[model samples]
Target: MNYIQGQTALDEEEKEGLLISTITTRAELDEFEQLNIESAIEWTLHKKLKKEQLLSESFVKKLHQKMYGNIWKWAGKFRKSEKNIGVNYYLISTTLKILLEDCLFWIDNKVYEPEVIAIRLKHRLVSIHCFPNGNGRHSRLMADLNRIDPLIAFAQS
Candidate 1:
């Protein structure tokens, strides 16, 4: 099966699978790379930080760097300058917010099934392309956690 992880605007087939994948897919995460998975975690932490939820930014940065430890030393840190992807231009944190606010809407909402929220967050995070890399996997983690985590999903949002 060919699956696109972080695609915000889905083709017809993707939308059908959206709710299904949010539940079953997160259970078996072997298809995703470790880096992608870790970045997803970092993105969630980033989202929380953006909300002023009181998590340490430095720790989240360490986690992000640990995700891509060998390849990029500056993994967790936000880029100092602006970035461009195709025609779209964005600052690092703005991209992060897209994942947090827009993509993670299910998590943002006051009440919803974790299963439901996961799909929404997953879909939206995939859509945001927040980081230069690992966005799909980041979407996955954000979705997965928000789906299961009532506290973070509710308190932070």
Candidate 2:
């Protein structure tokens, strides 16, 4: 696998989760994942999800599932083992709960502007690294969904 600089190399155990066994190189894997992610983005655009729904734990997992379910068996599930980054595997659920709650509180109280809230949520979500793979992409999409209304409004103006 010809990995580019800074790309996280999946361990053998993690690689075993790939649904496409024929994928042999980083480029092939990335292309497949990108296609899956594009479909997930389109799905989000069509769904009329409420703000609360977007911020919930279930939604997070569901979105991740949507993003990578086609190519990876562990798409929506939390990692079972510790990785180089992110909180311990045992802390994932509790830490994610707190982050979600905090995001809701920030929104309800107008603790920050929409863009700031999105950035904070994105940063925290990536830091948490909830899923086995696609954490960065998932977090970006989550942030975009979280602030979708404002984004649309800005585009229209």
Candidate 3:
């Protein structure tokens, strides 16, 4: 795969997950993923989601699935192998749960301003790197969703 500067190259195993076999370059892959992501964003905008639903592990996984399901077989699933960054592969579920709980607590107690909460949640989600790819884009979309609903800045992650 031809990765643009700053774009992370997918490992061979991860690349095999791609649904579109014709895409052999980063730009082509990016364009396809971007189109899929746009559809997912539209889906989120049209749906009626409760706050509790938004903050759950299922929602996070579902959002990822929506964002990349069209392009990757492993889109919504948490990675099963070790990577260069993020919590251990075995600890992804537990770590993400803890992060969500902490965000909930912060919101309940007004522990931080909404913007701070959003940024922290976004940063942490990216750090967690739950999926094999698109963590950064996922984190940003989550933060953007939070901007739409002010109750808590931690939105669909």
The candidate that achieves the highest TM-score relative to the unseen native structure: 2
What range of 10 consecutive residues in model 2 has the weakest lDDT sum?
148-157
lDDT per residue for candidate 3 within 36-75, as digits (tens), equals 9999999998876765677789989999999999999999
Q: Order the candidates by TM-score, highest first.
A: 2, 3, 1
TM-score of 1: 0.46
93-140: candidate 2 lDDT, tens digit per residue:
999999989877877777777778889999999898887778989999
- In candidate 1, stretches whose alpha carbon ends up further than 4 angstroms from where it belongs are 1-63, 77-87, 102-111, 152-157
Q: 2 or 3, which is superior by TM-score?
A: 2
Task: Work out the TM-score per prediction.
Answer: 0.46, 0.91, 0.90
Number of clashing residue pairs in every model? 2, 0, 0
Q: How far does residue 146 in candidate 1 sit from its true spot (Å)?
A: 1.3
Residue-level lDDT tens digits of model 1 in 1-157: 2345533332343224222234345324333336455564566554544333322235334545555444433355443332333114344445555444543453356456657656875665455444444455545654565555556556445
